[model samples]
Target: MTLLAIPAPAGWDLDLAHDYDDDLPPAGAEAPEQDVVAPDPAGLAAVGLDERTALLDAYVRGELGRVLHVAPGSIDVAGRTMNSLGVGSINGLELQARMEAALGIDVDLQRLLRANSAAELIDCLAGQLGPEDSPHKSAARRSTGTPAAAA
Candidate 1:
């Protein structure tokens, strides 16, 4: 949840269509568009042992969306690569910290870095919470289950 909503500086138009001098696409060429999906608070808040994996997926996408300044639902949580999502080392680190804090578990940053896609990253993080890891289980005590192993 957002703790603060910082307002943009007044009178400063930062949109690409307004203040930027970006090279426009060739005349008659249509710009590729991505569908932006609205945030789903209910989905984000979903809980339970059965829902644990889904919860982690939602959290990962939500954190990714926050980092990229996009809608969480717009993310292909199960497919898109972190590189395509614009998650470089800096933001990837931030995403790691956010997940650690939000999911109440210890995450391996190196493993996180090795993740090719958001789906893999979610699986890596959730897999660390398997029943064998009692310490992690207590940290993520809200529920217990081996989160689905994503492909």
Candidate 2:
């Protein structure tokens, strides 16, 4: 076999990989127009646990969006399963790391991977955010857009 000599310099295309070959829209179809909704910083300023948990929910959605490389509004996270959303071990780790650092909590990577839906994952992280905040309470607040019934 003959060896090829290297040139003095090589050109590289070091751009963020935007060529989503598997994700191309069908011909004669227009991509949906939507904007990723971001959480309000003011929500984080609230002293109540529900408000903070809700903020965490929104933040998890944004971070999950970044990991999945899709708009947060593009998916009904509450309705869709994580497997359908293409979440896997590696991306789960990526999402977990971002949430952990941003929320200042420890989330088991397995806890995240085992979640069946986006809301489930949100609940896990929200639970970690506070000792008294149960995952069910977080899920209820997220799903109904209202506080859980007080005991």
Candidate 3:
């Protein structure tokens, strides 16, 4: 077998033994101070039933609009069921995955299938979620229209 030699590009160095110590900060140098940002309490606390239901309602409506390629306001989440909306099993599964990912929770597929309407599905999801299921907290807090700390 014949071997071929390749030439290095202009200004490219092939050396691998250079000392890196000169590039590092002095041993006694202190690290720069960084601002510590706190996580939003609203995002970290488990949401109450009503708030979870509302969040789910909004999320479901948005997802339905995205999957069906319709306006979110036109979806009528509270008034219609998936079956009535012509959402097939595949679309239902897609919706389920989206909900699970958005809420950071796992949903039972069988229960999801059993939910006839968007409202029913939201109820089912809310029922399944425990206090520890997610970080978002009560609907009352969200409905007040101000952060708890600010209030």
TM-score of each: 0.52, 0.53, 0.52
1-151, model 1: which lDDT tens digit per residue? Answer: 7699667799976565663335866678764533334223233334433465676676677777787767788888666677777887888788777665555455556656656788877655554544543333323322444342221
Q: Report the C-alpha lDDT of model 3 over 107-141, residue by residue, as the tens digit.
A: 55555565567787766555544254444322223
Q: How well is each residue in 53-94 modelled by candidate 2, as lDDT tens digits?
A: 677666776777777877776756688777688788888777
* Comparison by TM-score, 1 against 3, better one: 1
Candidate closest to the true structure, highest TM-score: 2
lDDT of each: 0.59, 0.59, 0.59
**Order of candidates by TM-score, top first?**
2, 1, 3
* Stretches > 4 Å off in candidate 3: 1-45, 133-151
Residue 144, model 1, lDDT: 42
Better of 1 and 2 by TM-score: 2
Report how far off residue 104 is in candidate 3 (Å): 2.7
